[model samples]
Target: MVAPLKVGIAGLGTVGAEVVRLIEAQQSILSARCGRGIKVVAVTARNKSKKRGIDLRGIDWMKDPLAVATHPEVDCFVELMGGAGDPALSSISAALAAGKSVVTANKALVAKHGVKLATLAEKHGGALNYEAAVAGAVPVIKTIREGLSGTSINRVYGILNGTCNYILTRMEQEGLSFAECLKDAQRLGYAEAEPSFDVDGYDTAQKLAILASLAFGTKVNESAVSVEGISTIAAEDLRAAADLGYRIKLLGVAMRTKTGIEQRVHPTMVPLTSSIAQVMGVTNAVTIDGAGIAPITLVGPGAGGAATASAVLADVADVARNVRALPFAQPVAKLKTTTKAPMERHEGGYYIRLMARDLAGTAARIATRLAEQKISLESIVQKHPNGGLEPIDGTKKSSPVPVILITYATSEDAMRRALQAVQKDKVISGKPQVIRIEKN
Candidate 1:
């Protein structure tokens, strides 16, 4: 029998530890499938004296994390020590510069600096495989890289942050406010103590940048992806959306057109019956649209230590078997420099909620504002008064009533202006809240 492939791992954290477990549990199956056994030859972490829930006595321990990348006994390098810089970045560069394959589950490293690192790997004949970077266990990178290889993907996007999803779903379903839901999520360990990155849409934006590169042949542009969080999403708004047969979700959405690309992360109104709407709680779902082939949807646990580790091992196995593909599934030189499409050019539907003075002239004024901007109202459902009875109608000047409406297909720029006009009108009482709707 051929000897096993030697692998070294850095950061014996949740994912690193899971990698060890998976290798042991699926050793026989993986060996048969790949024609060689994969073994852990070395490992590293800050605390070398710590017990990592499993026996690490057999593997060589590295004092400096970079040593694992260049270990003489190890043929493959696995970077579970995250962060887009420092030991992880320096070590991976050294390994690739020395012409060795690498496997990593770091999305920030890829989304922020994939192009430079990928160029290095390709230059030195080293494979930088990172299937685990985008969404844990979703294999989205693989699907786009291989399955949709020939199609012209307009754009790719999805719910990439599990922590945010849990919070939003809680707010939408339980009537809990964003802060309340976020607090609960953190207590449950779904969200970090400092949850800004996940809750404020930055995490999703980073993941979308990676997906955007795969969907469109563009260099990953993390800064270009616009982001809006659910912090300001009112509970009353969630309840009002449910009444209009919609569910509120923090969506990382991108689209490409003749004009340019529209990348946004915000609170969106997904149709109640849509497959994405049903993806509640901490779960994640990604939708890919191609010009020719059928639209593909991949859904599963977006994150977890083991879930992410499984993906890292999948990439390692592919490398051990000598199977490889482009880092962004295309040559670095082939990736088009992205042209950030302005949000004004974005064409889509919207859910608009406005509070109006209780009078007959109010709705007409809103309709006039929308018409002025070429936006048509698809449906208008005047919210019943907060109490048991509906607000009594009065044609003459009277109190203000909350009006909720959904707009037909229109440019985002137009809708923003129309909604702005409605909010500013003398007949309206408060600012209008608008949520973009994804029909698919």
Candidate 2:
């Protein structure tokens, strides 16, 4: 057999150690598949003596992670050190400069600096592989890069964040509020103690930005993607969504429109019967709409050491076998930025919940506002006496009852204007909780 490929690893946290474990566990299979043995020869972390739940015997220790990437001892550089810049970026630069293959699980790095990195990798004749970056173990990147190579993909979108999904699933199933469900998720270790990144859809947005560039052959534009979180998804919103033949999910959407590309991450109401709706818990799923071929979807464990490590190892094997492909499934020069259209111009259905005065004509007043905006209601539910929660204070005693309405497909701008009018009325208390519904 050819000599084993020496791999250098940086970061021994959850994903880092898993890569080592997998390399050891799959040694035989990798040799057979890639025609070479593989081994992790060096590792770097803050503390050299730290116990990372794995045996660190016989491995070389590098105090500075950047040294590991630049060292001549390894043939490939594996970067599990996440973050868009600094050690991760600089170390990756050193690897590419040395003409060594680099593999990473950093979506933030890719979303923000993928184009430049791809350019550098190509310039140095170094391979930049990141199948693990988008959706943990799913070969969505590979499928689009290889399996569906012939098709022109127009849309690449899905549920990309597991923590958010788990929380949202519990909120609907247990009829708990967002805050309650989130606290439970944190206790279960499904979410980080500081959950802003996951709950706010920023994590999903980062992954979506990377997916958009690959699927559309466009330049990475993290700023172009609009993002919304699950923070405001009330229990009533989830309950009302269920009654409208839909289920709420934090969806990362990327689509090719004539005017420009539309990218966004938000709490979306999907048809209750769709396969995407049925996907629950800490699982990541992505669906690609190929122009001619059948739409393909992949869903699986999207986080943790075991799953993420599996991805890093697969990338290691590919580089060992000289798996040659474009840095981002396309040449950098071929990649262009998709025109970015505003969210208001896009057409979609919406869910609106309001606390209004219980008096007569209040409902008619709200309906007239919707008509003025050219928005039509697909369904309306006015609870004569919504006893579950009192209408938020300050509204007139004659305020309309808790009014929930599902509007037909309309412009986002129109919906916002209509909602503004509804909330401004003294009879209605607080802003009408609104969530958009997508047929997909």
Give the candidate number with the greatest lDDT: 2
Clashing pairs in 2: 356-399, 356-400, 357-398, 357-399, 357-400, 358-398, 358-399, 358-400, 359-398
Estimate, for each residue in 1-440, the C-alpha lDDT of model 1 and write its tens digit.
87888899998888899999899889999999999999998999999777778778799988877999999887789998889888889998888888888999988888878998899888988788888888898899888888788888975767788998898888877778888988899999999999999878998988888888888878999888888888888888888777777888888987877777778888888888877888888888898988976667789988999789878999989887888788888889998887556778777888876777765577788889989998877777666656222332443434666667787899988888887777777777767787888877
Error of 2 at 440 (Å): 2.3
Per-residue accuracy of model 2 over 191-223 as CA lDDT, tens digit each: 899999999999999899888888888898888
- TM-score, candidate number 1: 0.95
Please give the range of 10 consecutive residues that has the lowest summed lDDT in model 1: 387-396
Candidate 2: Cα lDDT at 143: 87
Q: Once superposed on the true structure, which residue ranges of model 2 sit more than 4 Å away at CA?
A: 338-340, 384-400, 425-427
Clash numbers, per candidate: 3, 9
